[model samples]
Target chain A: MASSSQIDLSGTTYCVLTGASQGIGRAIAAQVSKMLGPNSVMLLLARNKEQLSQTASLCESKNVKVFYESIDLSKASLLEMNFALNKSLEGRRVTDFSTSLIFHNVGSLGNLAVDTARMQDVPELREYYDLNVFNVIALNTQFLKLFEEVEDRVVIVNITSLCAIKPMSGMAYYCSGKAAREMYFKVLAEEKKHIRVLNYSPGPVETSMIDYVLAETVNKNLRDVFNSFKNQGTLLKPEMTARKCVKVLLNSKFSPGEHVDYFDDE
Target chain B: MASSSQIDLSGTTYCVLTGASQGIGRAIAAQVSKMLGPNSVMLLLARNKEQLSQTASLCESKNVKVFYESIDLSKASLLEMNFALNKSLEGRRVTDFSTSLIFHNVGSLGNLAVDTARMQDVPELREYYDLNVFNVIALNTQFLKLFEEVEDRVVIVNITSLCAIKPMSGMAYYCSGKAAREMYFKVLAEEKKHIRVLNYSPGPVETSMIDYVLAETVNKNLRDVFNSFKNQGTLLKPEMTARKCVKVLLNSKFSPGEHVDYFDDE
Candidate 1:
């Protein structure tokens, strides 16, 4: 049997990716853009205009059309975000493509200074979850609505984490958001049988998120563990992990709504 | 070995129960109130003032002081709700009791009229999650903060559901909220080793929630299943399930953060 990584995605694709300015999302945008057949479209969304442009440039291909949108996913209302998404499409129909793909990669490891006992700030929690959970739900909902008549298949990927299943002591907001988002997609998968939904957990990648966790997390033990991952050279690079993620999509053997981790053998 | 249902909880207690106006919450409030020792404090919280008063009366005991607070958990900010909680406490210290307990039972099964694909209204989603997820987190945080110095063990019980672990079609909001809240409490359990955390999945109880699900859920298959349960008289009575819940707490042999379902063998 051919390995998942060796399997190539063949066809013109319409892909929507969030957090495309940085880290795994940018890498995925670049990698997948290279893989998509002629006349494919890539819509990259993030808050950083300059970085998003950089990502779009990296994804530059004569065959693949790239569009970058700079919008704070956390700040915008669902309607506003939907409008932005529609504007990005520029009158393109999802059914025109052979495949409809969406990568829900935008998330935040919230202020780790507060543990569960001290997480009493309601607005903060709301904002955090808006970015991490609610926005994902809204975008996914919009994606389904827009691509309901897709030709081949609709692939929805949530950038999930082991934290979605396992609780880390000081990371309540992050864990809960992941858990909620993961479950929402699971339900979505069950409700819409035709669409493919996967919770892809990109393991300990060397992202700015790791740096934020190291600097901000109140749990010293967890901080040290992350520090060790950094020092021990075990942290996976963003491009490498992103490659694996795309490979998983290409391989397409995993069960619908299944959580596929980077470490899990194909 | 003694069956879990046969075990009894002893000593004076400080108990905080939310959603105490009706259904499983009211039932649990009444049952647990009867078990508490002399001078135990029973603080019942819910939006329905008349119903909350009724629950308080049901939990009435000369030995146990029952206090009821009327607050819309979904509307109140964390600070406001904490103020309400403090006002209800009326200068009573949590440490005065031998056991400190909290039941996070308040949740909503959101507007099931819309499927996951149509969950586009951001404000509606926010309000739903405020009641089901965020308020629970705020209250649980306050409970931990208040009961941190209790003399004996502090027990935190989340009135969870099978939906927390299972994907229910057309019930995206409820399932996601439960999953998030369960994971939050699990993190709390891990962080605070001295406290007992239980995610009790009360099986298909005969509550207004069941009635709502039967009436409003968009998925006919799920609605049919609930209708079958109701028609076949297989739905669990609130009080009976409440008794089982108290027994589980009293027995307390399960691992910390374990999810105990009513259908599971003792």
Candidate 2:
């Protein structure tokens, strides 16, 4: 008989990535599509549809499917977000995907200054919690709900910051939010064995947040801190940090629960 | 000369304590009134008006002024809570009091079993955060606002638990909430040098929370853990724990931003 080959590539991987519009999130989107190969679907969530669409196009692959959704993860409740997800996946039959990955890259470094900034700003602090912590818990729980039953592969990658462990002078909201999110993930790590949770610190990168601080921060200490780091050229490239994150995600032998840093990996 | 018996007791000390309806909270109320002397005012807060009134009656002192407010700290915002506080102190210009203290003794160990409980229970989880974390930040900020201008004596006592540092498998909300509150206080301690913030772990004590856990918990492991500690008589009396907390609060030489444990103190 003449040699013949057939390959069925359908519903192999499904990923939900938050804050995938730009910066480290965009870099991760581009790199993850290349790493996961074909027959996969990646859901890019962001509020800026234009930037999200650009990220989707930048991460385009022949066999891998990518779609960006314009949804404010910070404001949406678990029910609303879940409804959105189900609607997005409607009739796609993506449930049979072997590996479900959730990357929480959404964060807000709001008012990066020590001058007159106070935690008493309840609305702003709550907003930080909603974006950096609550959304992740909601989406991670949703993914665990889907994958926990079938005993399939599940992974959670939280883009945590060094501020989580080291408290900043003025960034109380950001620091505590990160700490709370990491603690939640730690508890999840203990609760679920089949699921792997990694709190990854993407090191200092040249993002808009840093640029904003460099340009507009009024706190002399914070300005000097950011300017010093930038002057020293110590900030890692986003692509390099994404590569480190992907490597950590693929390394199965490493134990979960603890935090991993990109600089340490280097 | 004849001794003057008319004691001019005015503007000596003011204290705000949450969860003061019963248990260690009531014990702390009793001891704090005695420690802050006769001119002290203790504003007790709780949801149950009857229980709070009863606790106030039980803590009646000839020296200190004791009053209870029927307000659920979890439901009220910082603004509303501050209004209630000012209303409670109506006509009593106690702002000039030499010492201002805030005791955060409120926390919820809701639905202690992880069986089907998810942080997706946004309302309940938000309640946990409000009662355990944000309220403390708000109240502390208020106190700091009152005392930060001058180098006055201000102390914040957060009634923490081992679960703050030791994450429980089933009590993710409780553990992470405590961690968030502690981190917030840690940040406050660093930002303001005039304030002393202590995350005081009262140790395992006999309280309604334990009784409820012992009575209505589905998690066998958690039940066994609580029962074993109870059976071994390792649990300290609420009064003893309260005394230890008061001792730590009175020690001015001790630095701030420290996690004080009752057992460790002994």
Candidate 3:
């Protein structure tokens, strides 16, 4: 384990990132590799192995070991699968390879329609909870274990949404799931003082999930409202958001128990 | 079906309430019975059959036909169980009933110290999510069908905690769970305009759950802090809290888009 005083990137650093195949997850993995250097071990977990391999290729081609696992995190069986994955990796003799950081960026906003009637449908409700809440909890439960004997700073960044703070039209289930994850991280931060847990609301970024929702049922007027925000050119880029997040994780000035919003920073 | 001018209490008014055996849930049932009279119906769901029987007996005497189901709502299978329960109840006279309200007031806080190392334990995490989130989502999904045909006011009140807004020690999991519920309600409120969804944070109250949490914890400083709040007479009675909640539910002026905290009123 590396000491906090002598923070050396040459020492083996392990980072487990979810949703790493595309969007913000892939960008985050890229940024972490550049910042932490070649000796750091990056475990990319997502549903798409092809994209994961592409991401792995982008990192520095030195001692950087990138491992990708393709699995559906929404399933209840993810807990067992994660345990097995950890067991398999236990034999690797990587000195100073401490799991110090965890990034929870896996989430999806399935369709956007303000239909109270359809909201109750079993399939819709199940998908909402599974993607938004269950996956986050399952992954976090698994990731938190790897930091048992942490010698340096341990950071867990939960990529929540600005929508989680308030409510939005046609996104009740999505909001509910995100809010659940936000609260979970908050409590986890307070309970586990040794590790820094950040419930980060990245505001509204142009992501595939948002695009799908907007295309589906965004009211003309509502679209105009969102367009105005986007036109202002304030929406965060995935890589830029990733950098800010990593900065926060690495910075010792920011306190452990806090909910940091990107909009709040502005 | 009652006309738009008349208050419609004729619909099945399918309500799913947790912790119905005692405290706020029982009070909510009593108030709903008084408000709706013989026209209203309640599905009393809780763990204690004897206590649920008492609640049912009391509610039936008020001319509010009450049906009790003894089941642990925290179980993972609750969503399926609730769906079946709703289906079985569908056979009873299909009146012009619309699902009017959903009150999620069931949760217990295990006042354990925050151990960062053990935070990843799967069993503990599962228990936390089950008690706080699963039941809330399950009940909302199951009863949402009852509100489909009518344009009546459908309300969901998720009982939350003050700790959710601010940080607290030892009660991290409890606070996180409540926060998750709060966010869920917020999203529900925004997405479903016809249905009045409220993420209500009720400050510390004299409940069996609170008593249990306090009894187990050995932190004198924390106990002193809680004692100060109690000594200050800020802690509300269960009945008073219930009555206030009823007022919020019945008040047409209370909008659906805001997070309501009881302490804010004080």
Candidate 4:
């Protein structure tokens, strides 16, 4: 409820957020709910039921109708069903909404290794693409359908990584997946003028995924580089990052024909 | 052999091209052979044996070692075999020289509308992704393995479309495939610093594919737009485009981590 009156989310009756269980997703959900009143409905999706419940409870004070689905989006069929169910619950037919905003914040960093040999051996390379690349494409397909039907100002915010822009030795697969998703959204934005698609590279954030990567990698050089980035004051907190994302989402300044990097603003 | 002295094909040792039977593929094969000289070798891959043989004959100038494999690159096993064969033919160990250069120029286009109602009904869509997206990823994976073993520079050129960059009706599936491939290469370029990758967008060329698209769709706007581009004297001939491509390949100025669009230069 912090300065929630500054932004108007009442018009945004329905907001869909993926990976809404914790970290940035949860923060975005909370911020969005506070902006909108109780009449507005927020749909949260994640794989963990307990975590999703916790997220819903955190946003309960906003008095908004909060809903969640504990489902893995990597499974295309399950995602399709969940999408259908969410539409049905809102009492709005799948094709009716004019303005729909989708935040694709779900991602996983599989492994970190500077050596190409070791990096390729990791099983998570393919899994990283499955979750980051395939899911992004599939979900975009689903959302585009609804956007076309509505033909309103649809905004798609894909949370990308700084590694996507700059070359890094470790986290090759994760970087590749992020870079692919970034360009996918850029192409989507260019081709479809109706939708405001932004591939925002949020640099680095203090998230559990980062901790996992730091713990798994044995390279001291990579760790030192990561630590330097943190010390440089480039790393953003989840709430602060979410605030910037919301500003961009609500702002009409962007032309929707290019990729927006969060650090580029600074 | 017109103005052959202006071009240098002597140092070019090994070359690999996909979809090398007909259309731009065949044209590139023939031109690349002439540019690379008699000692160099060309590995051509396509699905049509008869067409491959015919193209091989046209590309057999200057005693260039012409090798054609009528195997579909969509088959992962066949792709692996082709890579192994190329490495053996080069007389270098399997890990000696990474894939020197790869032209991911294979794709398919069908007159299909974006059927949001039945998103899965687009059968041709899968083939588009298989040829255009998945095959590119597979080839890059193989190339990355080779890159680690060799000290030489590797280049990957992905031939994408103008439709991938712009909006077009009735070609959503085709655009999606091309867009995905472009992004994949873009990310690969970012991830692997040693390999020079070019996500080249060729805009529109005078190919049979363009004729087919024009025949099926009512949108003459693209035709008119292309015609104007031609009127402006910028529509590149196949040979001219191929020569420009070879120039980029041979020149050291164009390095790793850059994307070049033909239209952008215009």
- The true-versus-predicted C-alpha distance at residue B142 of model 3, in Å, is 4.6
Best by TM-score: 1
- Model 4 earns a TM-score of 0.80
Better of 2 and 3 by lDDT: 2
Tens digits of per-residue lDDT for model 4, A1-266: 11111223555356678899998888888777776644556677789999999999877654466778777766556356446445634666644333466778888865564453223232244455557766656666766665555644466778877655554555555655565566556555544556666666665777787667677765565677777766787767888878777776666456653556665563
The pairs that clash in candidate 3 are A176-B184, B11-B96, B11-B97, B12-B97
Pairs that collide in candidate 2 are: none
lDDT for A80 (candidate 3): 57
Error of 3 at A247 (Å): 3.6
Report the CA-based lDDT of candidate 1 relative to the real structure: 0.84
In Å, candidate 3's interface RMSD is 3.7
Root-mean-square deviation (CA) per prediction: 3.3, 6.6, 5.1, 5.6
Q: Compared with the true structure, what per-residue lDDT tens digits does model 3 show for residues A99-175?
A: 46778888887556545334444345555666666557666666655455552456677888866667666565666
The DockQ of each candidate is 0.72, 0.38, 0.37, 0.19
The candidate with the higher lDDT, 1 or 4, is 1
- Candidate number with greatest DockQ: 1
User: Model 2 misses residue B46 by how many Å?
Assistant: 1.8
Compared with the true structure, what per-residue lDDT tens digits does model 2 show for residues B56-159?
Answer: 77666765677788887776777776775676555666555666777899878765654422557655666667767776777666656655544345667888
Candidate 4 lDDT: 0.61
lDDT of 3 at A127: 59
**Per-residue lDDT of model 4, residues B117-136, tens digit only:** 12343234344555666655
Residue runs of model 2 more than 4 Å from their true location after superposition = A1-11, A77-80, A83-96, A111-118, A121-124, A214-220, B1-11, B57-63, B77-80, B83-96, B111-117, B148-151, B214-218, B252-255
